[model samples]
Target: MRATIIHGAGDVRIETVPDPVILEPTDAIVRIVRACICGSDLHPFHNKPAGSDPRAIGHEFIGVVEDTGSAVRTVSRGDFVIAPFVWSDGTCEFCREGLFTSCLHGGDWGDENVGGGQGEATRVPQADGTLIPVPGITEDSELLPSLLTLSDVYGTGYHAAITAGVRPGETVVVIGDGAVGLLAVLSAKQLGAEKIILMGRHEARTNLGREFGATDVVSARGEEGIAQVRELSGGHGAHRVLEAVGFLPAYEQALGVVRPGGAISRVGVPQYVEAPAGRVLFRPNVTLTGGVAPVRKYIDTLLPLVLDGTVNPGRVFDMTVSIEDVPSGYVAMDERRALKVLVKP
Candidate 1:
């Protein structure tokens, strides 16, 4: 079997690895049909420690079940499925509350012995609890990109908007215009936000944001960007702010644009520690919240929309490549030449 391995920073390679097998009663072996590079994958791609072992890379995929453990009754052989980035058993207290990301027995794709999403096939523990079956489509369909996003991206963007409490007729500002950010703009509008100001400079991508429901695009940065949003919002700033970029500057910009009593929902895979508590926090009364999206919780709620064509978040994928060309897929995204890359295995 062939899959991706990260040898060190900037060193991603396709290599032959042993095929995975069911190791637990709750496990299943899924054959990859499609997978893709995520922005979060870039962090370790650029910052992985030197001399580190070649570890599996990628955490978003949609695949077919080749085999299932005896305990796995939720899905059977040959069922198409989407696995959230984090794997969990459905029986935990947190899972019961739809917080599967924090399930007592849950873990992520890259942690320790677990394999990741970018490969020919991988072992999925807690199959009954972790995999979401796609009914009516047993094989790849035209809805592939949209279904693929249920693994991480679209669900994440939806999380940011829901956490921020976007309201009908509210003016919202979304920081960043990457795939997730653009989808965040889409999410805001779907939630009934009347005016969406998307902050990004890339003409091509921001133009796509307009198609996604961004009423305004602010190309400015720093205080200039803040002022533009304020001007659009009549000097009080936006009623809600969605921080789709996880860096310090983007985080601060989200802070600067949100109105008093408004909230900031961030889901861009944080790169900084200790969100800077700024001086304006007290005077304007801004609330901050968001964490690893409970994508499993959102999968069912958003799947019907994707199937019915009410929303097609798959447009975020601007580049598509063969699975063997995965490294170039990463390069295209890292260089900003592609908004997102879709890989067919």
Candidate 2:
């Protein structure tokens, strides 16, 4: 088996690793078919603390079940399935309410001695709750990219829009132009946003945003960008703002373009923690809410669209490489030379 590992900043390698096996009664082993380098993965790729040991990387993948533990009854061997970036016990109260990210028993890949997804295979704990069977499965490699997005990216973009409370015929502005941000534009339109404004400067990426449903693309930055959005919204800010980039500047831009009473739904992993509530969040009377998306909760609502070809988030994969070339995938994404990278095992 081979897996991607990150030894420290700017250092990634594909090394032969031990094959995974079911270690718990509820575990399942999945032979990796497709995986991806996420925008969030770049955080640690470029910012991991110096002198950290090499650890397995990547969390998005879709594959066929090689085997399942005795307690795994919902899915059987040879079933094609997708697992969320995080693992959780479906019986938790928060999971019942569609907030699996906050489940009482939830964790992620690459921890607890679990093999990561961007590899030849992975051992998934809580298989009954974490691994979802892909409906009407066939071995069509073309469908892999789309199903792979359902594992995290599309579901995450869907989360940003849903939490923002995007409404039909309303004005919505999405910040950031990464894969998730581009998909956020698409999700907003699906939810019936009549006017979708995307704040991104990259010509190539913004072009896709327009194709995804962005009626307007604002290339300005700072207050200039905010002004452009305000003008497009007829002097008032957007009815809803989706912050898909978690940096302070991105967060600030989201607040800048949201209507006084509108909401900001963020899905990007926050790089900096918010300070104690202060004047910045007070004067506007706007709602600020978002956290790690409970991707498992939204998979059902999103899978049908992918399976039926209603939406194709797979377009974001600008580059693809063999699983062993994983380090270059990181480089391509980090340099913005690629919108997103896909790996085939």
Candidate 3:
């Protein structure tokens, strides 16, 4: 089988690799149908340490179950399913509490000898807990792109809004206009936020944010961007701030634009260890929250909405590529020429 491997920063390649088989009774082997490049994947593409062994990459995928281990009960061979970025045992205490990302037995793809999603197939641990079956939809349905988003970005964006406690008629500010940020705007709107200010420099991407429910677009950065968001929120800053870019500067913008007593929810994987925690957070009684989205927990909530056409998170995928061209997909996203790239294996 052919799979994607990252030899080092800016070096992604497609090469032949061994096919996957069940290593645990809870596992399933899924033949890839649709997969995608995530914004988080770019972090490693940009700064992965040199001289490390090449490893399989990619996490978001939708596939058909080719086989399942003896212990798998929720899905059978030939079932169409969505694989969350991480696999967790459904029986874990954290999973039961809707925090599958923190499950005691959970782990991410491309580690512990698991095949990555951007391949011919992958071994999905905790099959019953991690793979969500898609009913009544064909493999080629236009909704596949939307269903694919449930694997990560849509669920992640929703996590940002939900964690911040977005409510009806509240003011919300979403930082960034990437896939997650645009979807965060949609998520805030779904939660009934009456005003949404999207901070993004790209006019094309920000335009999508507007359609997603952003009442205003702030193209400036630093103090200027913060000022624009504050003015749009009627001078008090936003009731909730969703930071989708992982950089510290984006976090600082969130800190600047959130009103006192408001919350900041960050779905981006943090790129820094230390951030100002003194007066920036203490003076306002601000609540800082959000982490890796337990997307498995959100699949049920978001799947129905996709099936019903209430939302079209698939719009985030502006480019599609064959498995052999995945390296170019990464470059397109890294260069900001594409919002998100969909992969067809």
Candidate 4:
């Protein structure tokens, strides 16, 4: 079996690795058909120490189930499924409450001792809870990107909008233009936001954002960008703001562009800085919410949209590469040359 492995900072290689097998009663083994490089993968790809033993490097994938453990009932051999980036035990209290990302037994792949889905074959634990079966979707290769979106980006985007409580006729501002940001724009429109403002400089991405339903695109950076968002909302700021980029600047922009009493749904994975609570707590009743997206919760809601052609989140995919060429895929995305990269194994 072959898998993309990150040997160290800026180094990625496709190498042979042992095939996976079902290891738990709730596990399933999947033969990878398609996978993609996530923005999160770049954190380690650029900052992790050099010489760190190569680890499998992808989380988003769609595949055919080759085998399943005795406890797996929702999926079976030969079923086509989408693997959520986070694996969870469906029986947990948190999972029952629609927060599978925080499930008591949920964990991320590609961590120490965890087998990642970025290979020829990989193990999926709690298969019945983590994998979403896509009925009648086996032969369509083009559907791979959209199905893959459910694993992370699209789900996260949906999370941002939902967290912000976007409503019909509300003005929403989405910060960042990564895959998640672009999808946030799509999600806001689908949720009935009458005005969608996207803050990004890249023409390619901002253009796609418009096609996805962004009513306005703000190309200014920093304070200028914040001002543009406010201007679009009649100098009152948006009623809802979606923070899709997890960084201090992006966070500040989200806060600065939302009206008092509005909500800021932050889906970006915070890296090092803590948000200034005082700014939010003391000023206007601003509601703050968000974390890792509970992808499993949105699988049912989003799958039907994809199936019915009401949304095509796959438009964010600007490049497609072979699994062996994943190194370049990562570089392309990291450098902003590609909005999203899909890998075919």
TM-score of each: 0.98, 0.97, 0.99, 0.97
Q: Can you tell me which runs of candidate 4 are displaced by over 4 Å?
A: none
Q: Between candidates 3 and 4, which one is better according to lDDT?
A: 3
Q: Model 1: per-residue lDDT, tens digit, 1-345?
A: 888888888888898988888888889999988888998888888898879877988889999999998888999988999989989999999999999999999898856666778888889989988999997775558899999989988888889899999989999999999988998899899999999999999999999999999999999999999999999998989888888888889988988898998888888878888867776676678888788999999988899999999999998898998878989988888899999899888
Q: Residue 88 of candidate 3: its Cα lDDT?
A: 88
The sequence of per-residue lDDT tens digits that candidate 3 reaches over residues 1-345 is: 999999899999999998899999999999999999999999889988888988899999998999999999999999999999888898889999999999999898999679888888999989998999887667889998999999999999999999999999999999999999999999999999999999999999999999989999999999999988888889999999999999999999999999999999999999999998888898889999999999988888889999999999999999999999999999999999999999999
Encode model 4's per-residue lDDT on 1-345: one tens digit a residue: 888888889988888877787778999998888888888888888887887677877888889999999989999999999998988988899999999989899788776555676778788888988888887887466677788899899999999999889999999999888999999999999999999999988999999999999999999978888888888899989989898888888888877888988988989888756567785745788888888899889988999888777889988898999877888888899999988998888
Error of 2 at 268 (Å): 0.9
Lowest lDDT 10-residue stretch of candidate 2 = 273-282
User: Which RMSD values do the candidates have, in order?
Assistant: 1.1, 1.2, 0.8, 1.3
lDDT of 1 at 103: 93
Among these predictions, the greatest lDDT belongs to 3
Worst 10 residues of 1 by lDDT: 275-284
TM-score of 2: 0.97
| Residue 23 in model 3: lDDT | 95
lDDT tens digits, residue span 1-345, model 2: 899888899988899988898898899999988999999999998898878877888899999999999999888999999989998878889888988878788787888578787899999888898889986677675778989998888999999999999999999999999999999999999999999999998999999999999999999979999999999998989989999988989988887898988998988988887643465567777888877988898888988898888888999999999998999889999999999999997
lDDT of 4 at 265: 90
Model 1: residue 191 alpha-carbon error in angstroms: 0.5
Whole-model Cα lDDT of every candidate shown, in order? 0.89, 0.89, 0.93, 0.87
